[model samples]
Target: MLEEKKFFIHEDWVVVILAALIIALAVGGLILPVPEFNWSNASELFQTVLEPRNLGIIALQFTFVFIIAAIGALLNKRPLKGYLISFPIVYLITIAALILAGNSQVKAINLEAVIFSLGLGLIISNFFKLPEWLKSALSTEMFVKIGLVLLGTGIIFADILKAGSLGLIQALIVVITVWYFAYWLCKKLKIDDELTMMISSAVSICGVSAAIATSGAIKGDSKKLSYVISMVLITAIPMMIFMPLIAKYLGLSQEVTGAWLGGSIDTTGAVVASGSLVGEEALKISTIVKFSQNVLLGLAAFAISVFWTYTKHPNSKDPDSKPTIGVIWDRFPKFVLGFIAASLLFSFILDPATVSSVKSSLKNLQGLWFALAFTSIGLETNFADLFSKQSKKPFYAFLLAQTFNVVVTLAVALLLFN
Candidate 1:
């Protein structure tokens, strides 16, 4: 029998480190004079990097990522030497991709950093066989979980409150409606339960993160997860670029357009990109709506887990035995709790000025974590597996569901935001 791997630390320790890092950064921002920076334009971002202060920021980022990668190496029981050597290369590639995506021309087309990083990694992985040691360090799930926890720091409960009942209602309607539609469609197309859940969650909530969360809850196939992720990413690009243009052509108000984009776009990054194309008000409203939807991820995962577990084991020897609170708690994604805690802490505990300062300083770090995760995803995913014959049904199911989402969300945005 293969020996089970041992780790110096449990996986949960990574979550603690992520939480501590966010809190430390937030507190540090309050005490330190952090430099103001922008990546709004590619040329400007590249120029900014040459500045001493920005260079220091970059070094700090590298140090933080190195520590995280080291921890990942330990958890996977891998040789630290190879991981240390390869991590910098991966990090640099992801950073370069981010810079490229931030360029004025790329930004105009709304090609996000996540897409660039994934594409770059996919090209390298497909064209050349990567070293086994390097593959060992590609901890996509860990990076994504850390990113999600850090992402919580940016979500302020006050913002959700400010968005009012309409935002919550719209999110509820879109998530529930889209999720069931996708699930039912997949079943009709004879897709497996695992793939159906993954696609449904990706369509209804946030994209990659939601798919990851649901897959964990259902213990779905990694290749299926990658397929759903690819579907979301590919569909998101066109939606991100064209949605704003369509809104403009229809003469929709910025708020309505923002809500529509937020509800329809699978990824938060894509929603923000699409909303930015519309206007400032659209960007703000889009973020609020997206957050409102994201807040449902934990709940959705838990619900699916219960449904999966009970349905699969319906004839349990003890028919009287039903899933308990323990089951629900176990099924819930802990990172979501961290995200919520971070959001609540930033919104309610911190003073406004400190919160603002912290948000500004730490925002890019979250993006970097997500970029790394996407790069890892691309590196691990084989294009052939993602587009296999078994995936055809899921592809059609996702396409149909997302089209329905777009139409329904647009109508709801008009009714609520307009």
Candidate 2:
């Protein structure tokens, strides 16, 4: 007899279910009185976990982990026993990293939880051997997609509008210019198309999320994805801490400095950290500029999907076959649609107070999911392959592109905000 298909539920359905659950929870939090979750004491994981107020938050996290692990077990055609055994291990490790990241000194320097989580996971995976069952449930992409969908709830269009036309103009200029320049530089460096696309997207857009979305669109290698993520995270820290200092040294106004940090820094968290280092007004401007760039993520992913599908398919037998709308749709990353929908629903449908309340509760959960995903990336990646000869070109190209991005964005910020 033929072996039964391992998974009853399709992967696409898992995406849909997870996205719906996150959106539903956000909405529910608005109507219900949900306890606020804070990461301020993340360094004291044990103490924080024991606190009565954090009990609900911990339960919520475990619920998500259990759900995803169960679904992943089904998809891999594995026994749920392994998943149950492994998820807590991964979670505990992630929690420890978060705790370290939450230390006052670490937070002051902008060492984000995601970075620590990924680093700790890498150390464990490299220095010690892990059980196969534990590795099986890592599910890096799945966790990331879910996190991105939840992240959508935080992006409000009203805030984008409030950012004003100058912010939009600055964002557009930085994104388009940096994107093509990075793409061309990667091409010149002789990196492959998929890797180049991912690097460019990460540099030009929202860093890890942009890279993940591009990888999903083009069906890129997980190793390459991990490499790109590593680069983004490693570079983001110094930039986050020093950008504001540099702006201050130059005597740039808070608004101009905020716009520069927002447009230049690859990660949103880093942007916020850098912006805050400047002042309240700088933080506000930086957030607006970053959000304006963030709003373009879905569109950029869609455009890249169409371009890659039509221009770069190596197996296409017919040289002249025109790509139809259906082909583009098929190649598109479905999670992006969910991401956009969540943003729109939260931004347009909910009243301001409800949105604010929902965001406060849901934001930390989103960070947790992303932390888990980055940890998974570390677990699944081999250090040797990540630092291979083939990876060098892309790394240098990314560095050059990011340098160009900083200079250009600073110029644009001055032109627009100064």
Candidate 3:
């Protein structure tokens, strides 16, 4: 039994590499190698900005990944079997519902999310226990890092900067308040330090995605990752539904409120959904705010890691036992690379036509790749066991962080914008 289990883990590297190659190939096919196309300024209605046609293109491309993940989970019964199966299954269920309902764009985006989750789920479920050699080659940590690197390729920091001084200030204030408060609350609630940090960071930063990347970077507990994700998903839908309504009641400009909510919310997918409820400008602003928050991820991780080292281990010299300055660099998630790269390419080039095509391509690949990573995360961690713990600390931390973010961001946006 021991030998069999050992071999199982060793086999994971094969899955990791296979998963990466497929994702990379898809990206190359869609956006990496493609040339930009340009179109001059033209006034268009807000509804027209998110072309349903473009979303459809994304969905069609990602369906294969979802199917593989969902089907593979049904066939496996090893560790983390629930999320391993749920990742793909959820995608199929959600995307199929959208497709059947004739919401083509949503169907497409969901398709991308699903496929991305599926690939990751399969890899994490079965391979996490493989040989040290295989584990070394393509662990979840490696994939998340690589994903960050690839993400850099898709962002244009300059373009984000164009949103101006207010955007930067709002993002900075909101992220700082939320992250700090969440940490305090979690500690008060007596949650383990690692889990507390992750939940707080996820809520105050860019939501589930940010939480996942940061968790991977710091080698956080697996159970901690699941809790953060669960909170994000649970809070996301209700927030998405009510936030726009709240904005309307407050007489807040759609753009302002959307930006506030997007930056403050705990998940990117939900942010996009919430923004669409308002208008195109709101949608655009919200995404930028959210992205700006995302831009700070690398810096934030490093800062937090420094804090953890001094606080978590005052005297321990063992590098792995406590935070090491080197760990931040070694563990710095790589998806930031991909995000930064894309941003720079777009900012400098700014060729509308080619840029759009490339952006779309990268978005699709990012979505799919993320889905795979999600699957891996879900499969490796046991959700049932976690729920049983009733981690009051994490919950308290998330609530406090989100509350602080809302208060601080709103105050700033009002003072600055008004």
Candidate 4:
């Protein structure tokens, strides 16, 4: 019986399998069409977004992902009955958020669907009492890892190579420098290691996405992850609006401004929106810089996993005790392997034509998974815990790190792009 129990699949392994299976289906041409949600006005919204055909597409998407969620629940040895009942409600809520995000006015401000998803979930979870079964069924980590694995397909190495050498250089310097800076600040502030890592990654890397990835890699708490994510999203808005004004005021060139904005801002959408406020040249350069930074996400996750397992694992308390390779491997997040594999397959193995055909469908699924994860995160998190007295130090550390990020990135951009 002990031996049999040993064979019970870990959630991480199940995520890898499920992600790979989804990728296989996408590559095999079982592509689902992305529904049109963009609308400028209420009338247009009704005519285009709420059209019967579009509604059907949305329903189909829900059905596909629901099946995938159920399969994941089954493989993880969780109770499927509760998940089956709760997932549809989650899906509906996420859809409402998606529609709001898809509105033209929301797009103008560069708000993401996940933000609304998080907000709605928070509203529901905070105001009402939830059942234990519903809470139990919220598989936030699994959903995040699967979305991240699917996110890999978009991180084509070929595109990264073609982006710009300078962009890659800036990304490397900024991520490493800002990460350590944030970490050191958190340490000085007496923040816990988990919050420190999540905050550092969110500030230095790519905001919500980076925080989510780091949380999954380290198996951090959802409440802490939610806190970091909230900080990222909230700070991003002001940064997005003000950075361009500051750049213009400094008499910076579009190239320098673009690089600065790209490196400093957390989210891709925010980066793009901020850059566009500068000029077309700025828009292009900023995107290249952001994309370059995004490509490093996989490598960072791997390094963090190795470092965390080697130094922070329960068995690694003794300084002289070296963790064996097998132990490290056992501790690694297998979904990261799936993430890298998906990237490689899309980058080198698949033909461009095939990639183009399925890219939209896969991207949609990826966003949906991320949205679902954030919703779960919001549901699982308590309002007071998310912003408790204990969070002040981490919050201060993040702001200080972000301020440093902005100044340093501007200097780098001036040096490299000016």
**Poorest stretch of ten by lDDT in candidate 4:** 1-10
Task: Report the lDDT of model 4 for residue 185.
Answer: 90
lDDT of 3 by residue, 1-418 (tens): 5655432322223333434444455445533331111112222211332346534543554455444343333333223444444444434433333232233443323222533353354445455553333222223443344445446555567768787656677788888877777777777778877787788788887776577666755668765776677777666667777878888899998767867777767677677877888888878888888878877776776676566655655445663466556644555444444445445555675566666555555554555455445554555554454456476546666776776777777777666655
Considering every candidate listed, which one attains the maximal TM-score?
Answer: 4
CA lDDT scores, all candidates in order:
0.79, 0.82, 0.58, 0.89
lDDT of 1 by residue, 1-418 (tens): 9998854554545565655665675677532233333366556665775567877866777887688668666765667887778778888888778767766677666677888888888888888898877887667777777777777787777879876868888999999998899889988998888988998889888788789888877767777787788889999988888889999999999999999999999887788888888899999999888988877776777688888777665446876677676765555556666777777788898889887767755667677888888888788777788777877888999999999999999999999988
TM-score for each of the candidates: 0.87, 0.91, 0.68, 0.96
Model 4 spans with C-alpha error above 4 angstroms = 1-6, 316-319
The local lDDT score (0 to 100) that residue 36 gets in candidate 3 is 18
Per-model root-mean-square deviation over C-alphas:
3.8, 3.1, 9.4, 1.6
As for model 2, its CA RMSD to the true structure in angstroms is 3.1
**96-150 in candidate 4: lDDT tens per residue?**
8899999999999888888999999999999999998999988888898899899
Ranking by TM-score, best first?
A: 4, 2, 1, 3
1 or 3, greater by TM-score: 1
Task: Select the stronger candidate by TM-score from 3 and 4.
Answer: 4
Ranking of all predicted structures according to lDDT, beginning with the best and ending with the worst? 4, 2, 1, 3
Write the number of the candidate with greater TM-score, choosing between 1 and 4.
4
In model 2, state the lDDT of residue 350.
77
Give the runs in model 3 whose Cα sits over 4 Å from its true position.
1-143, 314-328, 331-342, 349-354
